[model samples]
Target: MTSISTTSSPATPTTVASAASKRVADRIAARAGDPDITLRERVALRTSDAEVTYAELSERAQKTAAELSALGVGAGDIVGVRLPSGPGAVAAMLACWHVGAAFLPMDASAPDAHRDHLLSRSAARAVIDGDGPRSLTDAAPSATGSPKGDDAYVIYTSGSTGTPKGVLVGQDAFAEHTTAIADLLELRDTDTVLQFAGLGFDVAQEEIWPTLAVGGTVAFLDSKDRALGPAELARRVRELNVSVLQLPTSYWRLLCAQMRGTESPGLSFDGVRTVVIGGEAAGTKDVHAHRDGPLGHCTLVNGYGPTETVVTCTAFVLRAHEPLPPTAGLPIGGPVGERRLYVLGADRRPAAGDSPGELWVGGSPLAEGYLNDPQRTAERFHADPFGSASGARMYRTGDLVRRHRDGTLEFLGRLDNQVKVRGYRIELDEVERHLTDTRGVTAAAAVALDDGTGTGGRILAAALAVTAGGPTAEEIREDLRGRLPSHLVPGLIRVRDALPLTTSGKIDRKAVAAVLADEHTAGEEAGAGVRVRADADAASAGIAAADTADADLTLLLKLIRTLLRAPDFGPDDDFLAHGGDSLVALRVSGTLREHGLRLRPSDLLTAQDARAAAVRMERS
Candidate 1:
């Protein structure tokens, strides 16, 4: 049986051994002697604090590499990097590559235990944080024994068993993937690409490596800009002349709404030539809006791949001149570069025509495997029996997809309990495990529910079976906040005596989700009632304090109520307590800006309630 190749161009006969072996750092180094002086001196990194040119960046990387070598870091070693997203972080990564060591990216904000776990598991030789590089282990370097010598990086993703698993990507695969992405996006030396994804994510590699490999500028969003709403983000992109934008689909949907809204005066993607959206399905409405709106000239791409595939393996490019697909949802199109995608059935054969099957990704872009976990590596990465190449393996994505008649793949839902929420891949069982471990929780089931905002956004919600006289829902959420990452924490938690169960004695997740949805709807209705009463009270007062600070508080409360869909609450009420998440906060801030007010999402999140937010707005 022969494997199907889904690339638009014929699959080139390239083996993993024959893939590009030049490191991304080496590629950037080679750009120094370019005939175009402007290209040689192009801005490699742009942060709010400073802009570093390609030559300067290269010098920093060399210095950092020397520092790492002094710490006895060498080929096949893993160096843990714990730094905030900035020039320093990128330089640290390049330094690891220069020393022929694999870089293990650790989130600067991650809990100490999480960081410790990753370090212990990866057996990192050194650590780099704000204080700079320090040796973590005195042991000698462990040879990876790969033809590629060392790995480029190892990124951890959410695992089902309550622990994150690290995916090891070889340098050859990394170089090939980044080069392919640069070509696919047609990135030029003059382009400025926005570095949006977190440093810990594989998408960050895509954002940084591809642009740098092509001598393009990689713009980093500062803390303030990172929290900006869609409108503000669009304005920032325009201000920076960002020509390429890679955003999560959920945020892209919001940005699309902002572009189509009447209040967004200067919100535009005027200079953006390409916009890549992934980590979740693209909404058809947003796709059509971008096609028909002012951004009609920009190329919109829907990229699809798991972390194991080294960022993106298949991309559905919606060029401005091409006709939009008639399907309801956008297709996750053909393979990029030397990558291969197959839709195989239960028998490990190609699925019958139009039949949905599991997505299996192969070729040079596939990662080596999960770090130090052979069981998982073996289970997910299977030998490619259909391929003629010896020892070629394909990753079983566990994503249900169907190859369209036109050869593009349309994503169905996941076959497992894993879900992508707001660009973060989460495992329900992992959340459930943490929930049950919480004090006073006997059982738990976490589920993703539509946020009801009509923006194609989903929020994490959990149903818990608590002990008698256990902690309140708010208390449980507070406990979870300390344990899980912010995104993993449930926005809405429902505590009940018992959870709904199926006849097979398993937790009925669907039933729980339905019940939670009903409760959410009821809460919104009650919030509407409170809003009406608040309006009535203000109207009955007859504009007596219409021009005062009290009036501003009322307006802020109204906006908050509308965004949260919750009933009116006191000045001390918490925004997050009323089902507000970061996305909702962005919308609130953006809407408030249109009303001649300025409040960052961070400010609103920190403010106790609507009244406090209004006060903060006044101070600003």
Candidate 2:
């Protein structure tokens, strides 16, 4: 099928189905200002190992569509996309769309527990995964579970209530999303991009399809290379000579660190071009670093969007030394296509320029609501009462922001349990969802509690369960590793017999907070005073903390809670159980190494409570 153009914008792609699916493949091939580019850099996917040509991919996708049709999947069926990034993943997704099915993209790198949870919750008819391009050719009636939202992918995001809520995005949204970036990023037929980020991340929405729409080369890195250290990533960028590279803030941080203060390898990149650095909020620190850093020729663009609004609702091309905030923040720019951004105050009235308010986005790009989640959908989305249409809906992004007089929007943090760590908006409840899926995990609650330490709060996780030796925190983590991304994983885990609940039989988060405070205080009391653990010479060495015994687990838990700057914590409390999460876990782990734990963040998270953690420590 070919992409259609809309009347409103000369660039908008059509939502009409193509009579022949080859049109989608040709659409990418035809974008060349010069149709003379070689096929190796055109339709085929180049990995570190093998390659898949566009013609082969198109044929395979068509065959896969036939297979899906044989299984009774047709137009208007929502197919949950739970696949790794590769030619196969691309083929499977296109095949679903070929038959008029919607493609919901999620990270397969996530803990399988989370992936499975999304499948069941979204009521997706069947999951389209990597092998589906070839494996599901034969019918398995059982695979067809339930269907919602006709012929388009409905990605289920995390809800404040901790349930995975599905958002119905049409092919029209995908077409527009691809069109916007293809024009904005200036993707051409010759561009060769390295698709390094997780397929599930919202940024990939801009990374993958737009290049495909423009008939550019997309190189898929091995999952291992994706997790590689800074030097390795820089080397890959040099080796691939990737023209357009899209990454999250975290990955960019690592690369910028390595590429800075180094001599250029002077590698030849015949086709390299622009770099789209998006997926999270970045600072002038990164912007400054990137401009002067190794990846010199590329430009860094900041994107802002809550998932409900379909990836980024705004974009900004950051010029160097252009005024930046102490928070290292930049503007999210303006609305794309016909999208309108309204900053509304608490009273639901539109906020004036420079006034902070909840960001309400409306217009053609708005997705249909969460599948099977009417209450939440009503809470988050509503009829634009102030607008002309009688039934027009606008998504209420529980984000706090101020509208600049220039009409650009700056991002503030989330108003709900949602958090934007490294640019991904994650629901704390989703971590709990994975915890529930683990063995020996009964009634688990994870929260972002401050350990009476640091400038802001750290994450704390608490769980109540009944089982032999209960599951070791590491074992529990093994389960989480399979279902969630690195950012969403909890740092610490507390195992309890039962979680505190309200009389309504719901988790009382505040009550749990009190438990963390009481225990944190007790732990602090155990080690209220920092003593003379360092020798005269050791102290003179200017070491932060000298010995292991000083920061013992009880003392360490006390110290961890203290270091995180929490109000209180005890031996029975958890660093993550109270409030520490994946990101905070990194800081704690780094601090402990300085104090002499000689441990990885994994060690702190897997160990039992403070006392048991002490026993597991090595004597130096």
Give lDDT: candidate 1, residue 302: 90
**Candidate 1 ranges beyond 4 A from true positions:** 1-5, 8-18, 33-39, 137-149, 261-265, 292-294, 535-547, 558-569, 576-579, 593-598, 618-620
How does each model score on TM-score? 0.91, 0.71
lDDT of 2 by residue, 464-552 (tens): 46476778665676556555665566655556777789999998888876786666556555434322222322243232344545335
Deviation in Å, model 2, residue 461 alpha carbon: 4.1
Model 2 has a clash total of 57
lDDT scores for all predictions? 0.79, 0.60
Highest TM-score scorer? 1
Model 1, range 55-155, lDDT digits (tens) per residue?
88888888999999998888888889999887899999998888888999877656666687788877888988988899986434653433344688999
Q: Tell me the alpha-carbon RMSD of every candidate.
A: 3.6, 8.1
In model 2, which range of ten residues has the least summed lDDT? 1-10
